[model samples]
Target chain A: MIRTFYGTDTLNSPAAFFIALTIGFFFGLTLERAGFGSSRRLAGIFYFKDMAVLKVMFTALLTAMIGLSFCIGLGVIDPSTEIYFMKTYYGAYIIAGLIFGVGFVMSGWCPGTATVGMASGKLDAVVFLAGSVLGSIFFNELFSIVKPLVTWGQSTQQNMGQEGLAFVYNSLGMSKSAFGFLFTLIAVVCFWGSEYIEQQHSDEIGKTGYFNTPFLRAFSLILMVSAGGLFVLDGSVNAEKHKAVSSSYGLHMSEKALLRDVASAVDHVEPEELADYLSNQDPAVIAVDVRPAKEFNAFHIRGAFNAELPDLPQFVQHHTDKRMIVLYSNGMTHPAQARDSLARMGFRNVYLLTNGLGGFIERCLKPVSLRKEPMPENSIRQINLWRAYFYSFDNARPSVIGSNPSADSAKFSDMPPFLPGFVDADWLAVLMEKPGLKMIDFRDQPEYNTNHISGSYAMSIENFRGVLDGVPSMLMPANVIAARLSLMGIEPVFRFSQKRR
Target chain B: MSSGNQKPYSNPYLAGVFLGVVLLASFLLLGAGLGASSGIARLGAFLSGLILPTHTFSSEYFGAWGEKPLHYYLVFMLLGVFLGGLFSAILSRRVQKSVVEKGNAISSKIRLIYALTGGILVGFASRLAGGCTSGQALTGGALLLTGSLIFLICVFAGGYAAAYFVRRQWHD
Candidate 1:
């Protein structure tokens, strides 16, 4: 795959700089050819006399857009990971645009065109260039004051689970090709509008009738057709292409070698050792939970993604030998199997979590008090810390005594099926959409009928309470609620929501 | 100044296609698009660093580029742009050393002052926006970025509106 030059040493090489210079050369030559070196031609758009600025800019943008979309459709480019998308900061960018526009008309040259103007022996462009440099320095001086504005809308996007950089199509949930087609249509319409405006002004541009030219007609037709082609090439093929590219990194070791390594216990990492790794949040360590999705979602170690045996290759494909990929399940069986597969798939750093989640829970999460023998001070301290880290549920028992990994073995049948928790309305809104999420509303039927969350079953707290042992409104026993939750398919992993007002 | 030997400019649409091809080349080769402001800013940093080493190195914006700010792809690109423009202007016989202003109505001195002020505003604004016309409006616009498109629209609107106030400077 042709990955981007970003983060690559080739970009810092002299040859790369030469390539940049060459690209810029053509960029300048094109600008000059289009009369961008002339302030009058650039400013003509504002006067409604000449629309070259709009015509040229829109055409150039459309041309590139078409090419980029085609590249994406052909599976030659992956815009999401390969290309650097500018982060969206609405407030800062908008204000900057307004200021830039005002400045643009005032100076008649942007940063790119100003260089061209200066080169063409325009003295005022020289002055403008100097002023621009000064302005940059000025901005640097006042960066502290402007920092807030720069970061204003970024946090909002982050809150919405966006990773700073977001594409327009991604935000709208529209396909890239679909968006490209629509954008091309808009550009074509804008071109016509610009031409009409210029014709109204009745300048040289109007007299030229560039819109009626055969070449432009063909160009527009071809552009529209190519943009339309993007729709035919769906995005799924690109994902398949990614998988094909990744699978090229085939099994590195022989089956016998992998078996030998596994037999020697060289690829096993103890649960306690993995706990130490998690505590520090080590970048080099990637913990993968090789369990079924249901069980993984119910409860997995923190920072571990659920992937099956087949998905292990793709899951840790990006990780090199430097990364320690620790795979775990309820026991050593699944992870060991996964480690063998990963080793065959060219991953040398793959390790099975020793004894898996069972060991993690038994040695790390279970309180030190239930041990058959007295533990050392260091072991006790470590156990306590691990317990706090992994099992912080306020009411859920750290472990079920004498149940032998009850959470894993009996599927939380021995423990309360739900952990009472406070979830904000926003969180509930998202949670309501998930499968197997049971929202039992404690509100009265009238209130529930008026406005309750969709799919919520109305039930009052009074229904779960009665005059027990001569006490009025006394809550039922924990076993009763646990039985009810289990009947409702609410596992111990289920978190009972107490919606914040 | 003589316009006798100068050649007429190319068709806007043709030139635009050429520019697009160049930009596409940039994306393929560099994995990034063209820009002019960053190069200029870095040049400024390099020049300033010569005189005031510590101050330039400690500057929030410029210092990030380090002592050798000119050792950047954009800086080389900017140099190429200048050279390419010079070559094109000479070939077309358009390099008549003169002040490019609207008309004779405004003196060159005042026109230069407007140019400086406008340049300063544009420079500052582009940095604040994280990109200039080339970087944001052109590159990001091609990528169909929502923010870049919005910025492009706002720029045109702001330009036309502000043009009214600055009309006197250009009125023939």
Candidate 2:
């Protein structure tokens, strides 16, 4: 990953301060070595004689510019990650430059070089430095007077349409590479021009020239710097590109290692083992029942979190990673899909229950279906014990139908939107005890007699259907059905009453 | 490696390459470049606050940096500038005890007065400009900032225009 410290809490620290000091040391050394410590050399630029200031400054500018261009091209330095560009204040820079220029000729020192000059034991540099500090205080003291002048043409540079030459060149259909090449060309030409002018000036003055470095040394150094810049930036370049692509595809997992993880996650846990975890209240376990609310309310394992299909993402987000998520359903299909989907999304903790809850009931609870193969005597005893606890209530029978089912005793919402035919269990429980209403069970006679809603009339499916070309259909007259319901103490009258305050 | 009584300054181009490497190191390691004017402004704020804390704290300009002026990275860099220059001067035998530099034509008192005036102008202008020569010219100029480039050109123009008037001060 690319590391950049800017616009973040980590940007400032003791370490950053140390780095700044080191760089400043080198900067100061370079300035002093280039004769910036002496104001005479700097001021000679104005006299059109010593072009060292311009020459040295331009060389540094071009080197950095070319180096940065290469860094950007190779994707080593991400400007967006770390670089901060100073806002342009056109009017302020112009006004400030005018003032600074006059000061430059008079004092022969700028702020940074003056410090270096002062170090050289130049008494004038120290005095001038103190005066500059005083001037800074004066500016701040009368800021309200200067604010208007400095703030003029402040916000226009942001658009860059009428400002930066790069924008103009780009808008004219020239690519960045082409522009960079042209820019480098211009810099080289300027470098040559400065050298020619300085040579003429040197001849006129009958003095030694400013630069005396051998051609090969300078040329080789430039090549070596360029190569070093490229080499350093290359490692993070590919990493950044991979990051962009991975994020675009919505995969945060290391794609290279994901297949191995997925291969191992296919291993499933037995229902008996899972029940032991639930009984022991193992905190590492998470049970997710992905079946419809009605089905889940009818019967589901204890401690399972219920969620609709569409609510899976939000549900998982709320309870993820802290434990081993065990997903199961009435069958394996939906649970398997949910587990695989979660795992594909970089969730490593999700697992599937083998054969689902149906297989669990068959293998561990059904007494008659016990396998003939040799089994542990203690395991059999434990299975029978759990069977009594889990399967004692006949969830399929719905013994107290409208009352809370055994799974309803487990945590789950009562109302399932897909089961629009059934009234809410809470509402139906209240209405079952009402005087005028009669609850009906339109199932087989044996099914109703064994277990039904309290005080509900037992009836067959045929009462609500008739033979139409040998196909069962709803053809009963409304009055006939009303009379049948009235005979069972159900009123046909509609109740409409208003309550008074 | 001329360890002698005095040596001429290094080749300007070679010195500049060294400067660029240092600047690049700054960008890579500190996410910043060399600067000076802000340090002086921050010093001003620190000093003014000592005299009139409430006034410095209330005013918009000084108030921004008045509370913790020296906390800035640039202040440390400026300190380094002082130290590094001293170290280089000592090694090169260029450090003098107390030498007043002035043209043969100008009196020491007059030269001192000119230096003070010029320093004041540059100091105030650098703050208004948001950076000095090293900050704006080298750092921002290399970044190809339009305002900085224009400022660099204008500084030269302004200096040339003013030099005609001050020519007598420098004439020997």
DockQ of each: 0.30, 0.27
lDDT of 2 by residue, A318-410 (tens): 777557778888877787677667766767567778779887777767663234222335657887777666654545322233355543342
Question: For model 2, what is the alpha-carbon lDDT of residue A177?
Answer: 42
> Model 1, range A1-501, lDDT digits (tens) per residue?
456664243665588799989988988888888888888778888888778888788778878877877786666765544565677778888899999999999988899999999989888789889988888888877876886777456413321223356567766778888888888888777777777777777745426756656776777787789788777675565565455445545557766556546544678787777888886778899799888887776677877767888887887876775469899999888888778877776778889887788888887777775553335466789988877776554332333223233222432123243444344344445445667567887744434544557887767576578778898668888777776666667666423243322
Pairs that collide in candidate 2 are none
Q: In order, what lDDT does every prediction score?
A: 0.76, 0.69
Candidate No. with top TM-score: 1
Candidate 2 residue-wise lDDT at B164: 76
